[model samples]
Target: MIASWRPGREIRYHTSLNEALANPAPLVLALDGGVFPFRGALERLLSEVQKPGVSLAYSSYETDSGTVEALPFNGDITERFPFGPLRAYLSERLIPTGAERFRFAWEYHARLALEEQGLFPSAIPEPLYFHAPDLLPRPDLREYLDSRQCQSGPDLAESFAYLRYPPEADAEFREAFYAMLRRRGAFLEDLEPERTFPPGKGENEVMASVLIPVRNRESFIAQAIESALSQDFEDYEVIVVDNASEDRTRDVVRGFRDPRLRLIENPPGSIAFALNAGLRAARGKYILQLDSDDAYTPETVSRMVSFMEENLGCGLAISYYQLTDENMNPLPDGVVKHLEYDRNNILRCEGAGAVRCWRKEVLLEIGGFDEEFGNYGEDYDAVLKVSERYEVCRVHKVLYFYRRHQGSQDAVQSKAERLNAKTRIRLRALERRKKLVQNRGNKRNTEGA
Candidate 1:
């Protein structure tokens, strides 16, 4: 019996994608919730998928924000979901493996399976459907990982490469996944021995420098300074690199009477520029990150300093943080402890965490943060460079308060632009990692011969 009726076609709805793929229909159209097709959506998708070597086809869609262009498919769907509400697949191309276990993101898993088989999706650049604005969440790792108990054999192997193992993953599964990464040349087996710090021109007593870069954040600048000063650690200095603020941010920073707090005046420039200035003026052995609009926990400085001192091989470290509103009240799902963070999978993710601390020599050697990213992805660029050689470790405690307010940089930046900038960083990291792995293989071959 026909489960549902569509215009000029009978729709058989299956609970799982596996069942649908098992029974071949010449063409398959998958619609996400709240997706209303435009007049010619199906025709356009069908026309595109029928083309030679095209296994899947998808079109852009209209959202409350605007028309989201069908992002160019690069055959690597593991990094992100580029398709929108409407996706059409050639029935013969969809692999039944790994499709049944995914309660949510099943389509995503199917796309990954297709990608592994060298089947890439074709894109139609125009809007073909209306996607509900409220349906904004991408496939979540936790939601998919929860279904792991039901997965085994080929299904598990197909999904394993894209999975980020948090502490929540079973011990056996985590170990096996890590072993796979090592064999695939994606994982670094061990950290390099500790390197010597750059020689100091003069004697400096500061062990850590809490670097705060500001532009027009007068309201919260004082709180940030206060929190830094409140640190239990004594051998640390607080350096505020003021980026020619039009507001009273400079005045508030000057009001601080502590000798350890110093403000450096800089011309209007990118956040990276301000940060580089802070790095130059910093007298501490380690540079700690503290945004002008965010405050650190009292133990933040002490904990980070101790970790860096104890772990000689670690060049950079980031601590977990609490996501709060401007009033410091915790937002829903506020505690951001990125337990899924692994050095091997850093290429596939965003930055590790906030309250990042880096060895001064390591920052200098990597030429500091890349100013090309402007304010958007400087931290991630730096993180990628540092992690390539030295260890990038995590401090498991929440030692910073990340306040989300209208005045925040992320709040003001265009979402599309920010996403584009981050995607560029990820692509660059991918190339760099590929080169590194290739070099390692060549070296091993030479040594064996």
Candidate 2:
């Protein structure tokens, strides 16, 4: 009879491979014999695979257990005895076999299968079976004890070579053998569905709308979404506009099914156009324009909303942002200056630099964004236009985290594009001021003369 299984306790039982095959709930295999021996290793391995979607598990072992004994499980014997039993339980299963001798067999079979089939199951670091030293066959005493004295030199040299130089020193050696096996076609099984979102009913009322325009960013998209959803501001909506991404960007966005998230597709347009699309659809009193690669702090939206509510005169408000690499580590001593946004300061310094949040009505009243500039300078242009009419405020805390990665528009855009766009807008505004000045000069001359 099988041992009773408890929720938090470990139970030990012996079963033939056939029995294990028939009962297919996830199993953790332990190797009780190898170079390393410990229960902690198995515990750690279990902890790693205990994540929602992963299966196939393992544990560490050492081969020098003080005694030898028979394989614990007994069952019906047939012509295909051990092989049939092994195949029944582990056949087509992508398991990480941990024995020294069996490692070669696993690697060889896995690689061959992968190369032939172009599909394989993952052999992750979980322990599903334990191989005890007592289970190993004893060396034949009668035929092997006296006949090995023929060549001590070559065998000694080979052993020394193996001891000194590990598997990596040989080019023909397989390093990621399991990976090779999975690639070939050894075990092409479907993984159980993994839950990506937190459990619970979602909030219905929208508090804030986060607009993100994505192009070809497939890697950083998920991280950005997680950061947004993780915000302390619960009543928020995330609007993602796909600007014709040729990568897995669509798939990544579709994976998130939060009630707060709404995905919109924009046909091959500029960043400004995509933002405008999201802006049109946004239902929040305030709109937060977050880059697809950037992330906000846990209290970003909440703090901004609270600050805006408390300070009624401020039409737009923004906090400082930390510049980080793709790995989310801060750049060395790299700090971006926070711009002061008083009326006098605005006149002297053009407009607020970098980041800013605005009232949705104010943003819309300023004609949303100048789509002519198309990309880089559009945010600055919109801020400049809005700042001319309303009070812009800068919060002193760092709430936004901007990622500096390759392929970012700021890194790749030409100086000419920025200069041309900025100069055109500035010149146009200057000409209007000049026309006003000329008209006033004419009026003063007529009145004085």
Candidate 3:
């Protein structure tokens, strides 16, 4: 076996395959700790590795909960290491899976590194290992991007190598990575219609309470208010929580004499706090959010309500939205159309559109928009929390207009602050997932003898 000369740190991963490469061992079976390989699992893996181009092989396994995660190998998803630890590898084809130097991402990067070199991992569609999935989420590019080193070079090349990205795409990769980083600040449409409510719902009760948390939005407040007032649905109210606006925002909202409109004088502070105030005052079964600077179409609320009504299990609903300038001129095409709720992709980008609606009960359960997240990331945090336990539906129609003006939060947020916010949100999401798993385990145990 080729022993590694890696010094300074002791992480328990093989540094290089050179030792295994030099040894006569034809096949190496890799299994994660706490995972039990079933009989013939190694043999089945071996049988596949003997075939051409099958550099690495992993098999489906039953999680501790008794359900199997029989995932097909997608080269892209290797970033998350969906291929759990029950695997077999050909000795000669082994790449530097990663050394003990950087403990976390090397494992996932190894999968990607191997794939970049045409080592497509072929999957064995049989249950091989018995283990529970890790409660922690896989490391994302943020792992690489969030390194606190003061860059001594124009680009992060050496760190890229450490992260196992191919050197050729450094410039292009930095651009793409930065592009996604820039987008972390954008809040997109991530909702629904219809007429039906649950059996106990009162006919006179508000169907949906559209909450607009506003502060100093004189220019766009009228448009937003008009949009809410114009919704075609029956039995809905608009609560414009004026967060101590210095401008004519209060005046603008007061100008509207609609009986359904209510104004709350919430002193300026956090948007989360404002949202909570609105929630406390909201009189509807469903709570929908509208930014002070954004607006909805006449049918946006109706459509969102209908969707949530039909998909009773969905705790939240967001729809597609068109990005336009302040004047409502449509932005050019190629904007990231957040059409689906890909769990991993959504983490990297807020593919969930901006216009969001939640079940009032669910909102209260999660403590109403997480006041800790404050200005930028509250919605994302809320979306993820509900999504982990309950389904989050995506409405295919663009029933909301996300205005991109000079005053837009994304445009105004400083780069360092944005990065810092995202870092915290990602960590919190992981921590939340871990707690969720623990909670599930505890519930199941309590229900047992």
lDDT of 2: 0.54
Candidate 1 lDDT by residue in tens digits, 162-230? 344444443433343344345445556555634634433237558899999999998899999999999
lDDT by residue (tens digit), candidate 2, 1-449: 11111224543333333333234434433221211212343344445345433332222221233222212111111011111000111222334332123322333343333323333222222322222323334454212212332111111111111122244422222333333323422211222211121222234435578888889889888888888888887777889999999999989999998988888988999999999999999887778878888888888888887777666666678788888998889888655554534432232233364346767777887788789977876776776565555556777778878899887887788654554565566545434434544565687799999
lDDT of each: 0.73, 0.54, 0.65
**For every model in order, what is the number of clashing pairs?**
0, 25, 17
**TM-score of each model, in listed order:** 0.80, 0.50, 0.58
Residue 124 of candidate 3: its Cα lDDT? 78
Rank by TM-score, highest first: 1, 3, 2
Candidate 3: lDDT of 167? 45
lDDT of 3 by residue, 127-147 (tens): 765553242233642232224
Better of 2 and 3 by lDDT: 3
Which 10-residue span in candidate 3 carries the lowest summed lDDT? 150-159
